[model samples]
Target: MGFSRRVGPPIVSAAVATLVLTNFAMVLLAERASHDGHLFASIWPIALTSTVAVVLVMSFLFRSIVEMGAELERREAEAQHQALHDQLTGLANRALLEDRLEQALCRYRRSGEQLALLILDLDRFKQVNDTLGHTAGDDMVRIVAERLRALLRDSDTVARIGGDEFAIIQARPRGEADVRSLCERIIETVGEPYRLGEREARVGVSIGAVFAGPDIATATDLLRKADITMYRAKAAGRHCFRIFTEAMDADVQRRDQIETILRAELAAGGGPELHFQPVIGGDGKIASVEGLMRWDQAVVGPIAPAEIVPVAEECGLIEQLGYNLVRQACALARRFPDLSISINLSPVQFRTMDFPAVLRRLVEGEGVPCSQLELEVTEQLFIDHGPLCEPALQALREAGFRICLDDFGTGYSSLSCLRRFPVDKVKLDHSFVDLAARDQSIALIRAAVTLGHAMNMEVIAEGISCEAEEQIALEAGCDGLQGHLYARAMPADQLQAWLAEAGKARISDAA
Candidate 1:
């Protein structure tokens, strides 16, 4: 607009002057060629009048053109702004954020002032999206965005990098303390409940922060490291913040290596080997054995069960890996036909509708009886999937496979879980077993055991590593007990030999 106001009038004036000069020059030439000065005088006045009229019309047209140009310039500016910002949140988009981060890096290179980059992922927002409509989800996002804007300085850049993911750039942060304060505030602010129309929703945030220093000189490195740390915060259990560390990078790399090896192993029709730990019955006989998956990679040494599940799930191999373990457990059931073979199930396995059907087919195909196979699921499965898990569980039960609630007392609403689900058994968590001597612990376990019996469900005490723990569990009326006191997890052949030896001891005692 300013350009048009300053330059438009000058261009219009130059054109009008050029037109008048040309008319005057033409009239003069005609007068000189014909030697008619009076004719020149008459024609000059008419030509000047026509030139004035033309200038009036042309000036109006030029003014309109200039105005159109200005409007177009304004529209272009708006388009650029829209391109660089998130349409929904109206915050800076990833492109603009990256650009600003690059500029900040340049400034840091010159001044050596510290800056912080934070990446946040909203936890449990998916539940809102799944249970409510997307409209509710959008409202939640807007609320979070507005809260973030109110919390931070104007100079800080907030970007919606992905759905349910946000990034922040704190240029000229006071120090690490400043960064920590900002992250803490963000988590607290965002974790507050949101109201969307008639319904209320809640979400938590996991934040990963990195400071610009000697190691983090580029935008990409900063973002990547912060993202890695953000996942660490999530793994540490959401609603917390984790600062970037070199060790985190190493762990991520190792996990990547494990994922690659697992992919290769699965593709080749192989996976983690199965080991069985015996669960002894009250009569001092082997009643059941829970199958535990073990991984001993030559390169990465031994991967813990906790580590294996996350890597497999991240790589989309959890179901396959889980099914493989089930098949192996079923095969072992054939060797010890009378012993119950229990296998752990990840919550991811219950996602599909065909999970129960798939398991039935696998076990039946291996010529194993469904009654001898027990499916162990954590209470988290119920909490996460809720009633949605009922159909599959019922189908498994109707098909003669038992459902045992693993880590029973460690979750919410234990009593309600027993009443709601068709759980055939309960495994008291090790934490309770360790504290069995306490009067409160004994009462809780005894109550749990009595409740299970009333529901016609078997109660098992797990993680009993000593005689004192075993006696406490027995006094609590637990029907079955399993832990290091009985036997550690062993390979299939070793377990078979152990079973054979135990049978002979029983026969000798009977004689």
Candidate 2:
């Protein structure tokens, strides 16, 4: 049997005692034979032979036990090593990295040496995983980990903290310059191309760095600061590095406050109002009004849709916000029998299979005609979540709702999209409207309008801010127009008055 440290000494002592007792017994037998005159020579030879046999057996048994114990220790050491390291890349994991970070912080506190943490996230990694197989993705991750280890100093620690996020700890750096140089090196190294099976793949990393300072007191704080800084680097543009700053913290705080206020507003049913902008038809009459979401906070006055809508989408409030806007639009449509209302739908709202059914129920409950309700979708919905979204969109279309492809000319495959989906209307993006005076731009706009009409779809020109642009759109054969030139989006009550005033102006001009 293999013996542990605590039991080995006792077992050895017992074996030695047993061997001594056997020798003593053999001596006693020889002595007794000599005293009884039974021939001492014969007895002495027999006793020696028996003692030799016992010694040989004990030696083999002890050797076997020692070998068994050594094998057990070897297996245990291997298990411990595997626990601390990543199995695929042989790099330290988050647990081991955190432990080392804690140690480094302690050393810094005692010696006042500089320590830095870098958090790296690979850009567009999901695209690689989605396009290539996950096996290739795993291979790519392993290659990245190897490259990171090769680039860093032996004193530094590198770890894979998430699927696409890696972290590094610099135990001792010369100064901020040295840390920055190291970060730049890491970016360059990780940005290199890799071979995955028969194809070559490319990716870049965004890094966030933070040095040990008075503000940082724990590993969690260090990591959080680094992550925030990394996001800033990502925002600035990928394939870059950013050092942590106090201003970044302030920005994060402001964002959190905005989200909190938005949530509170949504919960209290006082979130925002839907303002309608009228879409003028070819004959110069209001055909429909697009519902635009507006929010004016007590602290931040008016928050633009460009700013607040993204925040809502990020915080998972887009679905609820979308539903509320649809409800309000339905109510407005009921009030205005002559005009249809268009509501923009976020891509995030179509993640669930029941979205179509839920929207249908909401419209039916509001007693709004299906023909008077239009849902505007951006091109990104088809590009990003095509499979999950197509069915929902089809269901909505089959239920008698009009689906308009918004921002039509902005995407690369605008023409292809019209052929792929069953669309009722196409809203020309503002870019074309802004650049309509250019010959090439006009040609493109004219082509888009012609194609849209040929496809049996209505083409609406958006962002007609001036008379020049308005004339250009009308000349380009656009069927409808919507922009600041006519009127900015206003509350339902304000829109009613504007419409009445516009009607009076038209009547006077005719007379």
Q: Give lDDT tens digits, candidate 1, residues 1-511.
A: 4567777788888888989898989898879877748888778888989899989987897889789779878998899999999999999999999999999988888888668999999999899999998999998998899999998888898999999999999878887889899998998899888999998889999999988877776799999999999999998989999999899999989889889989999889886989999888767777789999998888789999998998888788999899889889988988888889999999888888898888889889999989999999998888989867988899999999999999988999788889899999999998876552567667878998988999999999999887778777887889888888778899999999888877334311311
Q: Give the lDDT of residue 474 in candidate 2.
A: 79
* TM-score of candidate 2 relative to the true fold: 0.80
* TM-score of each candidate structure, all chains considered together: 0.87, 0.80
Off by over 4 Å in 2: 1-76, 109-111, 124-135, 174-180, 196-200, 231-242, 299-301, 434-441, 503-511
lDDT of 2 by residue, 230-300 (tens): 99999998999999989998878877888898899889987878999988887787778999989888987
Error of 1 at 285 (Å): 2.1
lDDT of 1 at 27: 91
| lDDT for predicted candidate 1 compared with the true structure | 0.87
